[model samples]
Target: MKKTITIPLGSQHISLLEPVRFNFSCENEKITDVDYNVGFVHRGIEKACTEKFEYKQVGYVVARVCGLCAITHTMAYTLGIEHILNIKTNKKIDYLRILMLELDRIHSHLLCLAHTAENSGFEGMFMKIMGDRELVMDIQEAISGNRVQFDFVCIGGVNRDISTECEKLAFTNLALLDKKVDDLIGKFTSNWSTALKYKNIGALSYDDAFNFNALGPLARAAGAAIDVRAESSILPYKEVGYKMILGQNGDIYDRNLVRLKEIKNSILMCQNILSGLTEGEILVKFKGKPNGESFTRLEAPRGEIFYYLNANGTNMLQRVRIKTPTFSQIPGMVEIFKGSDYADAPAILASFDPCMSCTAK
Candidate 1:
């Protein structure tokens, strides 16, 4: 006997957790096909980038694309506009941008990790991850003065310098984080129930992972080793040096492992940037409008974020579009979830830690 059911999952989408809907065709409690629908939270961000608002003002507007990725959005926009303006930023500016970017990574990843734990029904571990997350948030608050919406990026460079006080507090949090992460590593591995639950669940082979076009920790956990930080040297990333984090098995456990390993790298990157502070102007003056098209990409905590812009030498003349990694990888969810039992759906979905606003924005 065979049983088939269609579970239309969500306006508060479950697959990638981004407010999209998916028509899931399941048979005998196993999903078969997942048809996706976005545009649920379309704020008309790209549409709003038209005229009326100056290029500089648009930076703040676009930064609101996703609170978690505010800095990355701003950086990408600023870079594209500068490229069109033919402005070359200095070395110090590049380093500062990267520092801010890494700080965002720490905050975003920690929050998502906490959520993932909650989804897995691990209440104790969930709280622990969130408790450690406060350290990163504190550091972010100290740096840009606002943890979530760091409106500190301007057109040419960052709006503020790395103060000594800021550096000290950030370092303190990093040290505290070191201790907490060590504790978490022990718990995640030793919690036999959790280990068994996540070990081989939602498995993906490297071939399937590549075909799905996964990015960031998700791709790395599957042993792809494809990181925009390494592939694209947009900032002063080449200076401090970083190794791509990867895992042998592409499963829920591997994703968790990759993210945990990345947290340490992010902390070290932040500390190194603060210690090697260089003296240079944070903001630079530029005149006129952009005249061409340009694209920028960054390794967001979830995955790769892509921004494409075209300018026409006017205050409000251009095109803007962004491709979020979650949206790109949504199809892959269908592939992995097809044979998975209904009970495991939510946990597997959360394992990707998908951010829907970011996806649809």
Candidate 2:
């Protein structure tokens, strides 16, 4: 008897934890052609903001677009709103905004690390990484009253500010986290088997990536210098120092490395920001509504996030659109998975850190 087996992983897969499709042609150990079909469920978040909600309401709406990227989404929407209004908040508002965003990165990176660890069958490491990340999440909640959806930002400025005591608490926590991150990174990168497992095993070469027009870690993993944070700061980000991390191999390993290093650098930036905290107002009052079109670009944890809004001097926005990082990364994912082995596909796919909701929205 002869049997032909064709295993298609998705438009839905268990590892993905989201609705997305992968059509994999596997002949024994090798994957022949990998075709990805994303865009499974696109929630109409833009309409929810522009049509249903008021200008002020859009911040929280956008923030909730991706739970992992809540603050980043919130910031992107707020920055867009601010652009339309041409409003600027005070100094303390800037520091708090940057601080919350960086903390979100730490949390997001930690979750990625944990998930990657679990995917690689290192459950112990996963548990420990997740454990270490809990404090950061707690710190996030302590600062903003919610771990994932902080709702920290409003149109004019932030909703809360860190006091001297809060600063002292954060200082203690970040100092400890810095040391742990160094140790975890040392273990992740320095181990021979681990290094080899990532370094070139899931290699994503150049041509395949560009065709997809991928941005963020997915593109950066392919050796693209496409970081939005390097030279541009959307708000008062110029005052807060950030180093853009890049990888040349464009493999799972390089992405893991970039995320790890970026997390460490974000921790350092938090320390630097906390040391310079001064007394000021958390937010400003924007009594007048906005008019005309406005666009905003922010360096989110995933990559550059763009928001566009058209206002008509009304309570609600005339139009709104957000181009999330995940949307840009999908095409690149399809390209890299083309010829990889079936076993290696999951890790390869996860390296991009796709957020389907963000993409669909």
- Which regions of candidate 2 deviate over 4 angstroms? 1-5, 206-211
Model 2 reaches what TM-score against the true structure? 0.93
For candidate 1, write residues 145-241 as lDDT tens digits.
8868998778888888888888889888899998787776666666764555788888877888899887777788889978888988677677876
lDDT winner among the candidates? Answer: 1
Question: In candidate 1, which residue pairs clash?
Answer: 18-356
TM-score of 1: 0.95
| lDDT to native, each model | 0.79, 0.78
Instruction: Give the candidate number with the greatest TM-score.
Output: 1
TM values, all candidates: 0.95, 0.93
What's model 2's lDDT at 357? 77
Report RMSD (Å) for each prediction in the order shown. 1.9, 2.3
